[model samples]
Target: MSTEIELPPGDQSLLLVDDDKAFLTRLERAMQKRGFSVRSADTVADGLAAVEADPPAYAVVDLRLEDGNGLDIVSALHSRRPDARAVVLTGYGNIATAVTAVKLGAVDYLSKPADADDVINALLATGEAPPAPPDNPMSADRVRWEHIQRVYELCERNVSETARRLNMHRRTLQRILAKRAPR
Candidate 1:
């Protein structure tokens, strides 16, 4: 059986699953800015608890958490709150996990250093389902890359803050974004 929700008119309540406290706080504030009510957790267990206790209308999950794979968290969300939408964000973007995320019922997948807006867009974009790509390539690559860059710039290239929000590391983010930067 499915639970009914009063569709959020402007912004919806959201569940944020990640292991970084500072980043989680920043994200929660950003979501609140967009009129969202955010309930946060630093591990899969905490996420499951929040969902079981007071389910949110949506979830913004990182593919990797300090304790375990965020996929497990997504699965729990689906099983407990089937109506809730999910968007998986990752720092180690790869094809296998990306496919698995969709298979597990995520609405979209994203790379790290992601902006709150792109995350929100993936959460709230309610029309024209994206084509089933054999592999979700870098089609959203340029736009996503650009968005992340601006965020990095805004954070003054502070790798810790950027990585925390993007769920990545100082080195990894530097390396990846370097590849995307213009020559």
Candidate 2:
């Protein structure tokens, strides 16, 4: 069975920015089906350019992009269109980053794997009430593993550099990265 997402009635365009090509493509289609006119960018440069050319009414930005942080995109969106609503999605969640995202004008910070429904709800929020917290938050181990993966990617998948930055043995970091993400 398939469920259809119903977005609020309007012709508002949404911008989706993520470095993962597959994810960006899939999300663009999903958002379109939900009734949004979607614009997608797979890099920070492209995202910023899209925002400059045409600021979207809403935006879903990945926290990490190939060229720069997703927060940069949010900041640009906010500057161009202060009323625009934005959400930040990240695989690696932490308090500091979450606060930073909000201060940069993201309406909400969501962990990755957020479905189309979740993104819509976040964007359409009235800002009068905070959304309910997740029923199941990430376990500490899961958070750790996600952080390691984020660092790994930031280092361009160089085990030595990732290990050095994390201050851990290269083999240990490698083993952790090799395993599937913790539940």
Candidate 3:
């Protein structure tokens, strides 16, 4: 079955900013197949340059990049083209960052590994109604695990710092970190 989404008549230019070369290439190809004039950048600097040169009508930006955060690109795009539709994609998804993305004019905030169809739908959605719930929402255990993992990463993977920040016992945090992520 075709996953292509028909975009409304307008400028179909799309800017995709991601650090993962493989993911960027795959998403670029997929978006092109779906009829977008796709432009991709693997770093925040390149992404900002693309936005300055010519802001696209749509954007799918990774929240984290090698040089800087992708939110910078999103901010620049919105400033250049207020009407542009932007979606922030991140592996470390959190409510605070999602709110910030929306405040900075992103149309949506999606977790990493989002498919082309999901990105397209988020870009084209009219915002007249709330988005439908995920078909397979993360379980509570998974959510907790993800949060802990995010915290651990933000703490520079220092178990002591992460545990202290989380108000969790060091041994407990270590145990959780050692276990595989919950589905």
Candidate 4:
């Protein structure tokens, strides 16, 4: 028993940009079910082209695409359509990147695996009131682990590079990576 989300009255055109084909397809179908006319792009170039061809009223863009960063798309969308609402989705979420996304005109920054409901709420939120706290926020250990994992991934899984970038001992990072994620 879930309450239906009421979209703000306007164009329902939406652009979905993500390198993950399966996730993109899933989100596309879900948004369509909720009445958005969805168009999708799997690369930064394609996303930019789509935005240029037709600016969408709403956009859900992944932070890291195979070809380039998704912020490019967000920036282009904002430039083309200042009234558009956009959300930045990422697997490697951090405070700095979230701030940058907001500054670049994203209405919200959501971590990956966000459901259709969460995305819809973000797209429609008026920002007049603060959002409620998460029911089960990640623990400090979990947050640290996630950050380390993100760095490791960004460093292309090179232990030395990740350790140097994080300023952490190689052994420490290796041990942390070896262990299972904290609750």
Candidate 5:
């Protein structure tokens, strides 16, 4: 005697768009385990095409795509498939972007390094759907401060080495650091 076995797929499918290969692979596995059949595209164009053809129940899109920006994808998705839910993932992590993504059609947005579980939770929290970090995490002032601190700690503060390494100006950097040093 012989037996035949088959498994039924879940009703909810997901589209994941990101340029990071490792992130996409890992997310694919995780989402699959969570009963979501995930389709991945490294570029926004491909994602748009997939969505057009298949129209998944949900989409996890990156803010930055290889071929084009993810914002464009979000806009298109919102305009084309109003029924589908979407979430935007980004590294820039700014409030403006998050708001824009939502206004465009994403249900919510989250920053990079967000875990699969967290992402799943966020999607669930959205009940459908998809900013930036506060003020450039690496602002010019922060850069100047760090550059000076590092240079001083090394006891050299050599303009050439510090500036060259940081791709900044030896003189300009020095001036910035000096401007903030309790003077």
Candidate 6:
């Protein structure tokens, strides 16, 4: 059981970019439900192409994609439409990347598992005040899981390489990576 946020209707266009197909689809539907004219891409290149063709009024981009980092999308969006309000989402959040996201023109940085309401608020809020901090932040175990997944992705999903990079036994890394992310 979930309650939906009611956002006022608008003609503004929005772009959603994430490598995870299910997450991207869910975000697209949620954004559309909230009255945004939403467009989605699952790769950085496609997202950049969309931005080049027509910059959106708002954007929600993942920090990492299969082909490249989502920051590239933000940069392209910036060049095409400097006023576009972009938010960067990541499962592996860190201060350095958050700062880089903002520097690249993202208005907000959100960790993964952000709900539709959070994303909408970030996209549409006027610059008066910041949104409230997340009530339930990721736990330490969740953070560790996210980090392992990120390392695996960065290694092109190569188990041995990721294990070597993470300095863990290959079997241990495999077992850890195989489990679903913790809540």
Each prediction's Cα lDDT score? 0.77, 0.87, 0.91, 0.91, 0.73, 0.86
Point out the higher-scoring one by lDDT: 1 or 2. Answer: 2
Over 4 Å off, model 3 = 1-4, 20-26, 64-66, 90-100, 111-115
Please list the residue runs of candidate 4 whose C-alpha ends up more than 4 Å from where it truly belongs after superposition: 1-3, 91-103, 111-113
Q: What's the CA error at residue 93 for candidate 2, in Å?
A: 4.1
- Per-residue alpha-carbon lDDT of candidate 4 for residues 75-174, written as tens digits (9 for 90 to 100): 9999999999999999888999999999999999998767787788889888999765554666888878878887898889999999999999999999
**In model 1, where is the ten-residue run with the lowest total lDDT?**
1-10
TM-score of each: 0.65, 0.78, 0.78, 0.78, 0.64, 0.79
Q: Candidate 6 — worst ten consecutive residues by lDDT sum? A: 1-10
Better by lDDT, candidate 5 or 3: 3
Off by over 4 Å in 6: 1-10, 156-159, 170-181
RMSD of 3: 3.0
Residue 158, candidate 2: Cα error in Å is 2.9
Better of 4 and 5 by lDDT: 4
RMSD of each: 9.4, 2.9, 3.0, 2.9, 11.3, 2.8
Candidate 3, residues 1-183, lDDT tens digits: the string is: 345467899899999999989989999999999999999999999999999999999999999998999999999999999999999999888899999999999999999767787888899999898766656667889978988887898889999999999999999999999999998
User: What value does the lDDT take at residue 87 in candidate 5?
Assistant: 86
Candidate 4 colliding pairs: none
Q: What's the lDDT of the predicted structure labeled candidate 5?
A: 0.73
| Clashes per candidate (backbone, < 3 Å) | 0, 0, 0, 0, 12, 0
> Model 2, range 85-134, lDDT digits (tens) per residue?
99999987899999999999999998887777677778887878887555
Sorting all predicted structures by lDDT, with the top scorer first, yields 3, 4, 2, 6, 1, 5
